[model samples]
Target chain A: MAQRTLLNQLIEALRCLPGVGPKSAQRIAFHLLERDREGGSRLARVMAEAMTRIGRCRRCRTLSEHELCGLCANPNRDPGLLCVVEQPSEIVAIEQATDYRGQYFVLGGRLSPLDGIGPEDLGLGLLEERLREGLVSEVILAISPTVEGSVTAQYIAECAAQGNVKVTRIAHGVPLGGELEYVDGGTLALAFTGRRAL
Target chain B: MAQRTLLNQLIEALRCLPGVGPKSAQRIAFHLLERDREGGSRLARVMAEAMTRIGRCRRCRTLSEHELCGLCANPNRDPGLLCVVEQPSEIVAIEQATDYRGQYFVLGGRLSPLDGIGPEDLGLGLLEERLREGLVSEVILAISPTVEGSVTAQYIAECAAQGNVKVTRIAHGVPLGGELEYVDGGTLALAFTGRRAL
Candidate 1:
């Protein structure tokens, strides 16, 4: 029998996503056909629209359909307390936690000199410009706890110090609601280092 | 931040395939945007086109872009030997093996009384009508080895017996290239029952 050419093409297109492989792509394509017609059309429309309309926010470099993203546009959010994150998904994770009530600056990616990713690649120049505006008082570096994340945090910390802004990295170690037995040795050490007295 | 409404919708819709979940759907939406614009458009075009154009073949009930599917239209194929299967994917798998030379009749689903699926639901009437045409000399039941597959096979066997047509079932149990030590007890038992002496 002849293959569904269009279906195969769509499946191939989906393989370019971060973690998707060919099999997953095929599954997704079939799922779209079997389940969500409206949803599939909406996805196509959104991709086309987002590609044309979404741009980097001028102030924070976060993805936005407008000149500024909602966080940057809001007046009530603390402009003095800015949380810096590496990717858009990280912003969503932090938002879900609902512990921070501050504006955000999305770096898009971290500095990885080995991979040729640098400060400019992550829009660090714009971050420095934002810090120089004199409205920000505290900067929270909420990047991943990887080695590259630590290096990026240090570089951003130095830049914040130069601008006379108080800079702090988010605490590392065991996750909330995690059992001690499940916590790894490296995380246990980090937890010990970040301990606070009652 | 305001949701990328259309993008989110598309992601949600694409999650309907058999094994797809939400995260994979999001990754797929992003992949389509970043790469494969041509392929993506082709998928969209084909989806819309297929929804408008493709239908079940009048003779065999297989998915067809035209009035008859490729298998049904080809004169070289044996019209006297008909292989019956449960789904389209099974046809693909059998085709990949390149051992089966006859055309197929897709039942769309099996007879599952517990699920309210019966002979009528599986289009047994059409099958009976096709058998009466006298063009079919033998009917091969190629359903899965599942309980439902067995029930469906029995039902079809009874239907073929009434027409005085020769009926046969594709072998069950141990797959080709399967090692006996690795085979499960249930499958091994079935293999022993269906065993052939070399």
Candidate 2:
């Protein structure tokens, strides 16, 4: 056990990350102190500020320092199309990989009823309210291809259908540059079924 | 480009860690904001406190909030046996793995000559002065087994010899619990050469 000092406290604090343990926490702490004290100081200051200021965007549920996030606040992004994702991390992945000029709606989580995550827990009512605005002509479901994700997509689709908006789930198949031999059986099956003429 | 905000600033700051890029930094920032805001705040507060207070222990060159580190100041540890390591991180690793009751001397870094790190750069003078004190009976070189590490170990051995102190480098062989089939060639050679008696 490390002595209860501020140094040890700093290391212990870093272990709250998903994969980081004591070794990595200590490494990161020492690295920050040795290499980038200014960055360490700024991280501390900004973390405190972000904790107090950042919250869910009122409209899309993405993290924001204000009522609305940058993606939701921009008028240039197409409001006629809305991409629904499980978390804010997926939004960043989509933005980097594709030229998606449409808006997004972060579900915050998926439908895992066994885990007590129901439609109500994921704010389906708010999603339906956004769909009823009539600005969105299409809603794209970009949830992961898990059982809970499928259920979430289905629920969101039904909600969107009520507003007469087309609901389309993102295609699941053999990924680009992925070898069929290495692709999972379920994905290969989907690719075979969704085959189209070149 | 992210908009300049406290959230963005925090994400940017987290990127200072080794192997952490923009994506991981953003993910860590969001993770903190959503699930562990309290932990994040604590990390921030601890980081600031540690940075402001923690400095090198004058005797051992390890991190300490005061003149001497806990290990150095403690009466229980053997002052006659000194463990020399390249970094503070290594000291933690050695302490956890072995019940070595010796005090430590952090070299901070090895002799990286290509990077222009000379003998003086590593504060070898301070180390020789410690050796000259005559209390140390043995100096254990726990530096890495790299080319530069070997050179640094050799140089320290010469310095310890001057004070009539026995200098020994930590053995390099297949790590404990590591399989022979999975082990690298250089390690296999070292293991064979340094084969222990049953």
Candidate 3:
């Protein structure tokens, strides 16, 4: 049987996602066709709306439907304490942990010289400008423990030092409830190096 | 920050796919937002249009945007040679293979007594009505080789025995280039049992 023209178009459009292959795109398209008309329409509407309305926060570069994101607009959040993360999803994870009560600065991505991703790509200039305002007292580097993340953290720390702001990287050690036997060598070494007096 | 009403609505709507969890749905929604506004709108339009127009063909039970599916409508297809399959996707697979040039009859599902699925649930009455029309020469059973598939095949074979038409089942054997070591026990057993003289 010939594929429906509209169905084919939908499948082609869904192929743009990072991990979605052609077969998966086709299946998703068929699923949308079989069910979820209301959901599909809603998704389309929101997709267009978000693209048109949402922009990076002026101070933090986090996605916001307004002038600033919710975290930046909150009066209860500590203006002097800032946690820096790599992406918006990291903000969700940190919020889920619920231990930090500070504002966030989303770097958008880490430094990758090989990939030509640099300070300009991550809005580091905006970050430097925010630090210059002298509202932030401490900048916590909550970025991933990758080499690229370390480079970005170091660069940010150097920039923050110029503004006389104390910069500290998040503690690295065995994760909570992680078995010592299962921990990798590098993490185990870091855990040993960062050990505290009881 | 409060989730935008439209964004949350879009995320909730995109969770209808078979394997898409909430996080993946959110990612897809955001991706559509970041790019592909026109494509997403087109997808929505197609989904709504296809759902409203596509329905089961009255004669063969295959998906049809018109009165009959392409297979049933094509004059080149042998109307007397009908291949029965478990789902609409199977028809697409067979069409892609281009090995079968006959019309099709979609069972919609197999007979699974344990799951409360029976002959009536699979549109067996319509199948019987078509078989009695006296124009059909051969009925090829192309359902899966599962226990349920066997039951359905047996039922169809019994019905064909009472009529003048010949009923045949697709071969169950090692696939081309398939190693014997990788073949499942059930398939190997079926292949052994169905072996023919040279």
Q: CA RMSD for every model? A: 3.6, 3.3, 3.8
Can you give the TM-score per candidate against the true fold?
A: 0.82, 0.85, 0.80
Poorest 10 consecutive residues by lDDT, candidate 1 chain B:
B45-54
Q: Which ten residues in a row have the lowest lDDT in candidate 1 chain A?
A: A1-10
Q: Give per-residue CA lDDT, model 1, range A1-198, as digits (tens).
A: 555444455666665555678767756655555456556665555555555665667878765666877778888888899999987656656887777889899887789999999999999998999899998999999998778988999999999999999998888978989899989988888899999889
Model 3: residues with Cα > 4 Å off, grouped in runs:
A1-4, A30-54, A111-120, A145-151, A173-198, B3-10, B26-45, B112-121, B132-135, B158-163, B173-185
Q: Write the per-residue lDDT of candidate 2 for residues A66-173, one digit (tens) a residue.
A: 788888888899999999998888887899899989999988899997899887778788889999999999999998887888888888888887889999888889
> Worst 10-residue stretch by lDDT in candidate 2 chain B?
B1-10
- Whole-model Cα lDDT per candidate? 0.76, 0.87, 0.80
Write the residue-wise lDDT of candidate 2 on B1-198 in tens digits: 256866778888888877799978988988898899998888878888887888988999988887888899889999999999988888888888899999999988889889999888788888999999999999999987878998999999999988899998788899989999999998999889878899
Task: Supply the DockQ value of model 3.
Answer: 0.36
Q: Candidate 2: lDDT over CA atoms? A: 0.87
Error of 1 at B185 (Å): 6.4
The DockQ-based order of candidates, best leading, equals 2, 3, 1
Stretches of candidate 1 off by over 4 Å are A17-22, A34-42, A176-198, B3-7, B22-53, B112-120, B145-148, B176-189, B192-198
Model 1, total clashes: 2
Residue B112, model 1, lDDT:
94
Find the candidate with the highest TM-score and give its number: 2
Residues B71-160, model 3: lDDT tens digits? 788899987898999887777788888678888888988899899998988889889888898778899999888888899999998887
